[model samples]
Every structure is written in C-alpha cells, then in structure tokens.
Target: FFFVACETHRARAMQDRYVLVLVGVIIITFLTFHQEICKAPFMPHLTDPEPPPLPPMLMQSKRQLLPDMDAEAPPATDVPSPTDPAPQLPPDPPPTGALLPLGPSLLLYKPTTAPMWDPTFVPRWQHLVSIPIMRSRHSMRLLDLCITSILYMTPYPKFDVLIMLDPPSRALIRKSFLEGRLEALNAQYLMVPDPIYVDDFYTGKYWWVDWPMLTQYKKVLYIDNDVLINADLNDMFDAYDMEGGGHIYAAQEGEFWRMWKSTPMFGLTWYKKTDYDRMNAKGIQSFNAGILMFVPDQIFVTNILEMRKWMLKWMEREIPHFTDQSFVNHWFNTRLLSKSILHKIQLFPEHRSYPGKILLHWCASFGTPASVKYDKMSSYLTTFIEPRLPKRYASRDAMVAGLLRPQMVIAEVGCFTGNFSQVLLETQPKELHLIDWFKGQGSGSDADGGTVVKLPGDQALQMLQDRFASSPQVNIHRNNSLHALAALQDRSLDAVYLDGDRGYDWLMQDMLLASAKVKPGGWIMGHDFYTYDRVTNKKAEKSLNPDVEKTVNAFLQASGLKIYAVGLDKQTSFAIRLMHPVFWFK
Candidate 1:
C-alpha cells in the first residue's frame, strides 16, 4: 500500500508543470499581436519621406488619387494624377517595323506646353511708325540752318527726329532747338564721334553711324542737312507703312532717273553676303548711300558693312568718284535681289529741282562759279521770286492736264510756256488738241489779241482749249490724247507735237498718238531734245531720264517720222509725216 501512494504523487506533479508552460506561451502570443496593430499606421513613415509634396499640376484639370472608388475618387472624367507614374504609352511604330515591338523598358512623358511655332499659325499686322534721320557735322552751318528752317516752317505737328552728330554739335543742337522753343517736337539726338578711319565725304561713314537709330524706328526718313521741308511730311510718313517689311523704301529720286543710264551703279544694292563678296571680286557697283530707307536686320547690317568695306577698298584703289553715295548706288544695282524694295518718292522732280531737295530745288545744275553767280543774281533780281506760282502750276496744272488727255493721246510731254504754244497757233486748223502735262495760266497774251478760252471740262480738253485760245478759229478738245485720238477718225489731225518731258514711257505714248492721228505731211515736234542740263552731268550714272540720244534715235527709227528741223537755241526737235501709213488695218 506504501509503494502505490508514492507513484500517484509523482504523476500529479508532472501534469501540473505541463499546464503552467502552456499558459505562458498563450500570453506571449497575445502581446506580440497587440504591438503589430499599433505599428500598422507608422509603415508609411518608413517608406519615402512624405513622397515630396506632389509636384504642382496644371489648373482646370480634375486629378484623382483613387480612380475606381466613387466617394474618394474625382469625377469620372478626371485625368489621372500626374504624380502617380503615368501608364506607358504605346511606342511609336518604327518606320521599318511592321508593328510596335515589345520592350522591357518603356517610359511615357507628356508635353508640358504647346510648341512655340506652327505651320498653320497666322501673323497679325502691326502698326508701324517712322522717324526721319538728319545727320550733320558742326561745321556745316548751311545744313543746320536749312534743317532748322524746315522744322520751324513745316505746317504739320511735331514728328520724331533722329539727329546724328558729333557730341559737341549734338549738345548744341539740343540746347538750341530740342530743349529750347522747339522742344514740343519729339526729337532724339544721337551723338557719335567722327570716324577716324573714314573721311566723311569719301566713305559716307557718318551715314553708317546713323543706322542704329534707323533700325529702332520702323521707317527712317533720311534727309540731307541742305534740304528744305516746305510741306508737312505726314503724307510721306503715311506712305511708308504701305511698304511691307524687309524692303528698302525711298523717295522717287527724280535726279537719279535723269542720270540712271550713265551711272548704272547708283542707289541701294541688296545682296546676300556670299553674293556680295562675289560682286566685289568682279568690281561691280552696289548701292546708293544717299537719302534712303533701310530695314534693320541681320542681312541688311551685314550687307551694309560689306558694302562699306568695298567702298573703302575702292577709295584706296583711287576710284575717280570717291563719294560713298556713288558706291552705294553701285552696290544696290549689282547685288541686291530683284524683288528688293524700291518705291519712287516723287516729291521733287529732277528736271526742275536743285542738287538736294524734297520738293523743288531752285538751281540743281550750277555750272562754273561765274554761271552760278549769274543765276543767283538773276533769281534775286527777278520780279517773280514767288514760291506760290511754281506750286500752283505743279500741283494743279500738271495734274489737271494729265487727267484730261485721252487714254492714247500724248499731251505736253515737256515743259511748255504760253508763248511757245502761240507760235504753233499761227497756222490754225479746224480742231486743236492741246495736251500739256503741266500747263499754267498764260503769262503773256497771244499775238492775235484773242480772249483765252480756258475750258473747265475734262482736264485734258481744258488743257487743249487753254493752249489753243490764241487761235480763235481752232476748236479745242482737252482730254487724254490717247482717249481723244481713239475718238478721232484715222489720219484726221493736221499736227501732233509730243513735248512732255515726263519720261520714255510718255515719249512712247506720244509716238503711238502721232503715228495714228497725223495726216500726210502733218508736223510733229518735241521739246528738250538737244538741251543738255548740267544737273544730269553730275548724276549721269543714275539719271531718271533715258539718254536723249537713245530716246530720239529709237523713236525716229520706230515711228518712221522724218526729222524736219532741229531748233536753233532750244532743245526742240521737229519731224513731219511723209505719208500716212495703213497702221489701222494692221
């Protein structure tokens, strides 16, 4: 019985130990689960540090973090958050590949902004303004005085002035006019030191310095210091805007036309750099550096520099005409693109105007000192020093006469006075067609003492009536000679004289009219045929009018008109119809 009780106590003690170990294991497992739950929210901190406050996105785009969920999600149309790596877009199919090849590495990037330029883009027109440039030396008092007079006398309101001068001279100009009484005008003075390397007259270097100011303004009016701006330039400035960009605009240099054939190298010549060098190698004339409008751009600036260099070289080589203006004309004619900008500013007519003028130059071609003195004395002594007379004739008479002539008729092609017309009126015909492109009121009465019948109908007809009034027997029809000739029966007119000195075009028109109207043995005469003016001598290379030699020769050959007699003193040449040709049938 003692052995049995000892065995039972050992068994009970072993069973109690097993139960305590199981309870300790269960408590440890519960503590581990509670710690894991507390650390769940902190898992984000262990990852990237707040993921760099998502980059700024474009406004007006609805972005969503969770696209599928209804409550937390943005609208269905919302664009995906750019921060959330965008889905890889399909690769652009290679030109040679049949389909887009699968690739392990593919990245998609969205454009941030639209392209700067596009093929379909249209440009808007911009309003442009221009300033005239007047550059002068301090020593040229005549230029300064004239310019100052022009500024004061102009009827228009103040316009922008870009004055380029020596520093001291610039200051003096500003003090005298810009800052003083004439400050009301918008004027900017640019001071530039006289170039040490280039002589002023030879290289026209001063003009190059003024280019910077010209570029700043849309259009630049370049006037010589000797110019007299009698009229308001608002019309000229308004005309500039009509010239589109990348063009060189200029006033119709009437003087240039008169001398163009002689100096084929006169005026602005535009050229690409490569071509300019080629031209220089060939020793061709490029551009005219005198009064001109240049567009400030890379090509232009480069061309100007190249041109100046060439001119300097020419000066070094002892070219006869050392003037920069001459070089400029040479360059433009030789190198500039055919499509380059050329507009004729016809304020001044070369035939009448002096050396430099916007409107009318009193004495352009003064010969020897003695001749100049005589002209000056004559001008001063003349009773009619009136500016109004010339203006009236030029503006009203010239324009009116041009309008009245027939479409095919050639009216006064040259300057004709009343006395000259009366000489023709001595042999009166049934009907007289007097065409004067520029006809003024009669200064002297006709020899016949007949009252002048100044018609006020079509300008062309009025011109004829006014001209033939000396012969009361002749009925006058003032209209375009072309239109008048068209109405008349073939070979009906007794005489036709095309004396207008406009240009070759007018001369040709006159030939056409004379050929049609004149009967057998009818007389035809033209003025200014033999007269050689000195103004034409200086600018022979850039003359506007064709060489009278060539014009007369060509017309004589083409029209088959026989030369009757050359005038004794004047530049007049007369011709007569030998036989009326059957041109109408042809």
Candidate 2:
C-alpha cells in the first residue's frame, strides 16, 4: 500500500511538470511572433497617436463641427471596455424629439445652414427612419412602392420618414408625384448634396446623409430604398430604444468573408493572421448595412470629424474592393461585436414567406441586376402588398368624385360658399341640391335644450347662387338642415351630405332625417366626423368637432346602420349606404 501511494505522488508531480513545460513553449512562441502579430490590421494600436489637424477644406467648412464640446479633445478612438460603467446621460427629453440642452461636454454636430435637400423637413420626432432616393426612372418607381408600403402598413402612431433626395431627383419627383401622393402621405424630404464619387465611381456615399440628421433626431434608422417593408417596424424601433441608444444595431452579413479578408476563414489577402485573431477575440462580426439603427448623441456626433479622416485614409490606402459597407463594419466594429440579436431583420432569398418578416431586403449581394430588381419589386407589390393596403384618397373632393356617378341625385346640407357643391357638381349629378343656412355655424342655446340658433344666410346664399347659377343640374336651398332633409320624400334621394351644425342632438337629428330620405341602396354622408388613433381607437385630440363622432356613433346604434367609409382629411368625412329599412325608436 505504501509503495502504491509513492507511485501516485510521483505521477502527480510529472503531470504538474508537463503543464509548466507547455506554458513555457506558448510564452516563447508569443514573444517571437509579437512584432508580426502587432503589425496586423486588427491589432489596432490601443494608444494610437492623436490625428493630424483638420484639412483646409474641413476647417473652412460651413458647419461648425463640434458645438459646445471641447475643441482640444479628440474623438473617442475605442469603445468603452465592457467592464467600464456606462457614461451617465442626462434625463430623457420629452418623446416629442425636442432638443437637449447643449452642455459643454455634449458634442452636437448640427447643420448651420438649412438642409440642402428640403427646407420643409422639420423633424418633430425623436426617431427618424430615412430612405435615400437617387435620380433615375427606376428609382422613382421604387420610391412609390417604398413610400406606399410605409404609409399603409404602419399603424396610427407612424414613424417619421425622411426621403433623402439628390438634387436632380427632387425636381423630377416634385413635378411628378410629390404634390399629390407624397405630400398627402406626410413624408418629408431632404435635398442631399450631389453624388459623391470615390475613384470615379459612386461608392454608396449617400449613407452619410443620415449622419447629419442625428443632430436633430435622437436616433435614426437608415433603410435602403430597395428594402420593402413587409410589416410594421415598430417592434424593431422599440427594441433599439430598449437596448439604450449608444450602439449601432444591424443584422450579421451571412458570410464573414464578404466583409473581412483574413487567413484560414477568409483566404489570405493583405490581412494577417493576427488581424483575424484579434477581431475574433474582440467578438467583431460583419453586418449587412442595408438596415441600421443608431443613436445620434454626443459619442457619435463627436466622432464625425474622425470619420472624415478615416474616409481619406481608406481612399489613399487604395484598400482592395473597399465600399461603404466595409468601412462601416470596421468603423463601428466594437459595437458590432455586441450588436443586439433583436435587430436581425429577416433577409430575402433565405426567407420568401413575407408574413413574418419586418423588411424584405433585395440585397445587392443577390447579384440581381437593376432591371431585374425593378420587375421583381413591381410584381411583388402588385401581387402581394398593394392588394392588402387600404384604399386611400388624397382629398374629400377626390373621394366624392370616386363615389358619385353621373346623373345621380345628390345634396350637400352645409355647402358653405359652394366649396363642396363645386365638387358635387363636377361629378355631373343628375340634380344637385345645395342646402345651407350659410351664416357659418351657429352657437348652441343652453336655454333651448342645446338647440343651435339659426342665422340669416343672405350673403352666403347669394354667393353660392352666383357660383352654381349657370349649372342646370344645381338647386340651392336656404333652410335649416332638418327642414331641408325633411322636405325630401322618404327613400327618394340617391345621396345626402350632412355638413351643417355639429351639435350632438342637432347632428343626430340631421343624420336621422338624412337616413330616412335616402334610398335603401343610396348614401347618407357627413362632414366633420372625428378621426381616431387607429391603434388606440381614441378620438384624436385635434378633432375639431368631437360631438360629430359621438352623434354619428349614437345614430348608428339606434338605427342599426354601420359607417361604410371614412375619408382621410382634416375635417373627416364619413358615408353610410342605406342598406336596410329605416327603423326609428320613438
């Protein structure tokens, strides 16, 4: 037994000696290769010397780079170590995207002059998701689909969209669709500086356009134009905010070799063994730049100047096949390592089922030629997306034009100064009756049980008469809405529009009377119907006549009639096709 114990102790000593020898070999090998490893691209000098002074052009630039920040201080060259505590940030500003107080330590890069693209692009939100549009026939087509999808798919609390337009495209889009479609969609625009070319080729320089917007917005979600929105991006936006705003969030590019060139994994190029090893050690992985979410705060704002220097460096070095995507992956490599997985929006080709994906990115890596992409996007929109989107009319006049048919009898109860009467007549209604007390709206009398006091309609009546006097189909009536609706035979008129007094009981009576007069298959439409937040179903605070919605809803319950359609306009319009027999309880 004692002999066996001695043998065991000797074996343990041998095992310890073996470990010591192995450690010595590793240390010697590392010392011999230290210089070569340090020379690798990924072994970035942690203590890099301060960059040279700003170039003449950058110095003389119109935008004063770092507002209220330390002029002597250099931009952050490295990400805060994971063990380091988070830099204390000021309390969150209101969600309205109001500007934070400019403290001496807070570096902000705001434009001194107005935005070159569009002066009207006043950002009122904390987060803005921007899409860049270049001048071309194909691009214009893409813009239509992109904007349409965003406006349609996004619910009530929609994300603010900034359409970054090059100068040439701005003129063409403004002339063609901006006035009618884009404007109605409430999409904003910014005229970006002209196309920037690197080595006589456009290398996606437009991506930088969003960098400046961070000054105005707390966060910016940069989306490529070719990227089609399949579902609401609200979840993605919320996820970004929840993670805190300092990091860049993007999906990993499936193939690492596409972004980095190193030994073993990526075939040998300029990148050395140590470069790849260091990147792996730091947890850095390349990500697709198609969709990126980043905060525009002091950290990023201060680094704007450093980014410019890096651009120059990459250009002069003549890096092999360098592009904006490659630059972005390296520039934000630190944050890339810990990029939130929640930001991995499903990519295309890999996933064809559109039901679950937030965005369907037709990435350039797919090698789809521009012409082919055009056809595919158009076909996809027409087949799957467009059909699902709700039908939207730009104006009340447009809605009326689509609904009314030629030779149909129509009456507008509050046709003040014949604004809508003109619209009704344009439809070539068989007989258009214009009714108004035209004294504008009257005040409700509390003493008379909320009865609206009718006023004289002399001037307005005369003006309406002069405007529609030449039209043979027009008939003007100067009377209260109740009397005007009552005089008509029951179930006789094709359609009647109630736009008079918005008082609760008065509107209820007007709706009841109009319902009885319209034919079973005809319409009873009204103006000033309140708009509601689509998500919350709460009446919008800005709704002028809140009582109109109350009255319309009350009438629907009592009469068993449902609201057929609601018009998207400042003063909301609604229609109710009289589909069933009229039944009034009392």
Candidate 3:
C-alpha cells in the first residue's frame, strides 16, 4: 500500500507539469494569430459573393462619376486597437432604383397678419372645424394673410391647416383659440421662428408660396385661402406629372409678353431670351405661383434660399414687381431650360384667368376696403358654395336627439310650431303628445309677442297636424299643458319636455305635472333654463322672461332632483330619476 501511494503522488505531479506547458504554448500562439482572425471586415451580407459592377440606372447616364464597386472591399486601414472605434466611411448610397420621399405630406398655413374678428358671438359650425370664424370685417385676403385663407379654400376632408406661428404670436392668439373660434377649421399649430427667407425684399405677403418645403409636403397643392376649388381636386392629383423626376404645376401669371422685361428678374426674356422664344414658340405660358401643385426638390428649396443671396448680388441690377413669383419664373424658365430638360413647369393655360375653370380664383380679392362690397362674390358664395357646404346639427338639436328613444311614450309641452319636436320625432318614438293652448294675447311689443305669444294658436296646430300626419306616433293636444297632462295616466310617460309659456305660473304648473306623469326612471326637462339677466337681454336685444329659469330651479330643488345642462349654451336642462348610481354619487 505505501509503495502504491508514493507512485500515485509522483504521477499526479508529472501530469500537472505537462498541462501547464501545454497552456503556455496555447497562450503564445493565440497572441500571435488574434490580429489576423479579427482582420476579416464587416460588410452587409448579400447573396452575391461580389457586389454587381454596374452603376444604378439613375446614375448611369446623368452622374459624371460613379462610386467604384471594387473599392467596396473592406480596407486594411489602421488596425483598430481594443480602445479604438471602427473607421468611419461615407454611408452606402440607397439601394439601386430605390426612391425615397423628400419628406412627409403636410398642409401648411401662415398667418402673417391677424384677422379682424369678434370671437364670442360666432356660432360653432361643425362643417368648419378648427378655423377661426369670428365676425371678420377684414376681407378673407387680409385674414388669410396667414391661416384664415383656408376657410374658403378646397373642401378637402384631410385639410388640417398647419398654422405656422412664430412664438410671440401664439400668446396673443391664445384666448381666441381657447374660445374655439377656429374649432371648425381643424387648425394645427407649428412654431417656426421665422420664414426661410428673412430678407427685407421678401415681405410676408406671398412667402407662403414656398409652403411645400416649409410644411414638408414632398408633393403639395398650395392654394391661397382666397381661392376655392369649384370641383374636387382629387381628379387633379393624378393629373400631375409625378413620373417626371422634376415637375412644377402652376397657372401663368399673365401673357409672357406682358410680364417680359429687359432683365432676368422679369419673365427672363433677357437672361434666356433664346430659350424663352423657343418655349414661347412651342406655346408654353409664363406662370403664377399663387396656386401650385409641385414636388419640393432640393433644386427648388435651394433656389428659394438662394433668392435673397442672388438678389443681394444683383442689387446693383433690377428687382421685379412680383418677388417670389418672378424668382420661380426664373427657376423653371432659365435654370431647367438651360439644361435641355423639359423645363417641367407645366403651366395651366386657358385656365389661368379662366373664371369657369375647376378652381375659382377670387383673384386679388383680399385686403380691399370694407366699404367695397363684393356683391357678386357674395352671390357666388351664397348660391354656389354655401349651398354645397355640409349641414350639421346644432348643439340644442343634438341634445334633444340624444334623449329620444323608440317605443317610448313622451310629451312635448308648449310645442309651438313643433320646430324642436321635429328632432325628437327622428327617433321614431312609440307616441309623442304635443301640448299648447295656441292662444295668448299679444301686446304687439316684441317683449310680450316674442315668439309664442304672437303665434296664431289654430294655425300652429294645423301645421303640427300636417307635419306629423304621416307619423302616427305624434298626438297633438291643443290646450294648456297642465290640463293636457290630467288626461295622461300616472307613470305612463318615459319622458316629458316643458317648453311652454314663460309666465311663472304656467312653467311651474307644467313642470309639476310633467315630473309626476314621467315614470320613476324617466326624464324630465325644459328649454331656456337660464335667468333673464343683462347678458341674455343684451344678446336677445330685449327683455327675456326669467320665470322659466326660476320655475325649473324651484321645482328641481324642492324635489331634490339634480338637473344637468344638456347644451353648450345652457339653454336646455334635464334630470332623470334618482335610480342610477351616477346620480347618487354626484
């Protein structure tokens, strides 16, 4: 046993020495070979073992020099140590024939001058979202000096006007915005410190003509707010020549001969007289920048930025009457024409000053004196445009609509002329009782004869009877509402609406009976649930009856029923039975 143990210890020590020698050899070898192993560079994996030698199709003929494919092999430049970053090279060009968009599609607005408006009295119109519709004495041209122009522009649903505001103007317009004068127009706010061209020569007037790059719509339709499209512009979208890499869509300012000058600043008759003559002989017209559909290229954006620079250089020379428009004329007619390219600016001929065209360019209509009546334009808007605008429900109408349910019994008290009752009947309810005596003495003064007091009771009933004759659901009771409800069974009604005479006794009498007649889970409501204060008097231009408000409050307070304002104007108020947990919690 002692001899075996001694042999085992000696063998173990020998094995340990052999392992250490083997490890030392491996360490030395790895140190020598590590650099070469990592020297294999990273390249994007493609199926091909080598990159294709041919240049991209677009680059083949146009580009003067193409990047060498062989140079794509990983360079054996300075070997990066552990702490060193990988060597940087210019990024690989986009894949062959891969077209990248210039930028996102956007709608832009520039409010250079504030509009003249009274925001509060303006009605909330659902058709015109996010557009300020305050009572404006200023012509649309003045209001559209920035953002207001879009109010009468194309009725495109996707038009959420991107109002480009400098930081300082935001605060000044904050109140008008909060008041929701612009809610109908769908206004979006963007803060630009200033325009791209901040030079003195570029007045804020038509600078928004460059809205394409400013709002970042690679392809854009820039219509001045004053210009309204008589037809949908969707058909016109495909009409644009997007296949051509460079294109500009605009109307000719006037005849090229009329705008031509001895210098390049005009229609470039002097700078590129030969090219102008050539295109002119081919029948191309000089164009306007006002209404345009164009792709914003680096070429155009560069031209815009260089306008100030170029003008400064040529200041010892002439400046044209129209600033940005002339610059754009020079860009297409001269710059692109000289390159033997198709000048690509397809001007809309026979359509420029053609009033009967798709676009109704109420040309040069802005900033005119208020006394200068646009009676013809008003007729056009009223007859052609206003009739075409989408009709929307008023807040009061929508409130009445929400409460109505089919297969329910309801009563409308003091339903003179049944104007509001029309909204309720839309639900096709099982039965609706309309109550009004249709007889009240009129003092001839508007204060007493306001609406119901002067209405002929017998004729009003005839109208209601005829209006609802097709609807078997409506039942008219030509009597005072209080006496009318006595005939109705207790807990028989699902809802009761009291919009009767404004006298305290009349309102209270009707409300008390309506509350009792409505089922335990039913709705009880009234219209004009507001005090006749100075605000109301001033708005109505006469004294309003306060009895409607007083009677409603008293009845609801005494009955311990919580009333909810149904419309934004607080003209309608309603309360349901105290059965729902929502009412209890409130």
Best candidate, lDDT: 2
Looking at model 1, residue 328 earns an lDDT score of: 54
* C-alpha lDDT values of all predictions: 0.39, 0.58, 0.47
Rate residue 460 of model 1 by lDDT: 38
lDDT of 3 by residue, 123-206 (tens): 222121121212222333223322322323332233334344443345545534221323334445434333222222133333
> With candidate 2 superimposed using the best TM-score fit, by how many Å does residue 383's alpha carbon deviate from the native?
1.9
RMSD of 3: 23.2
Candidate 1 local lDDT, residue 582: 21
Model 2 weakest 10-residue run by lDDT: 101-110
Candidate 2, residue 556: Cα displacement in angstroms equals: 26
lDDT of 1 by residue, 1-586 (tens): 3433444455467766655555556557768988866643221111223322222431212323212222332222221121233323323323432211011111111222221212332222111122222233222343333343343333223345544444345445544433331232333444443321223323433344334434444444555443444444444455444333334444433333334334423422322344445544543433333345654555566656555555543332233342455555545544432122324332323324232223222223212222333344234222222232111111222222321222222223322334444444433334445544333432222212124344323453445456656655543444455565566675665456665443666566656666666544344555444433344422124323345545766766765433534432223344433232423232
What TM-score do all the candidates reach, one by one? 0.32, 0.48, 0.36
lDDT preference between candidates 1 and 2, better one: 2
TM-score pick, better of 2 and 3:
2
Flag regions of model 1 displaced more than 4 Å. Answer: 1-140, 149-158, 171-184, 195-198, 201-213, 240-246, 251-289, 337-586
- Tell me the number of clashing residue pairs for each predicted model: 77, 3, 22
Task: Estimate the overall C-alpha local distance difference test score of candidate 1.
Answer: 0.39
Show where candidate 3 strays beyond 4 Å: 1-156, 165-183, 190-218, 233-246, 262-269, 281-283, 311-320, 337-358, 365-379, 389-586
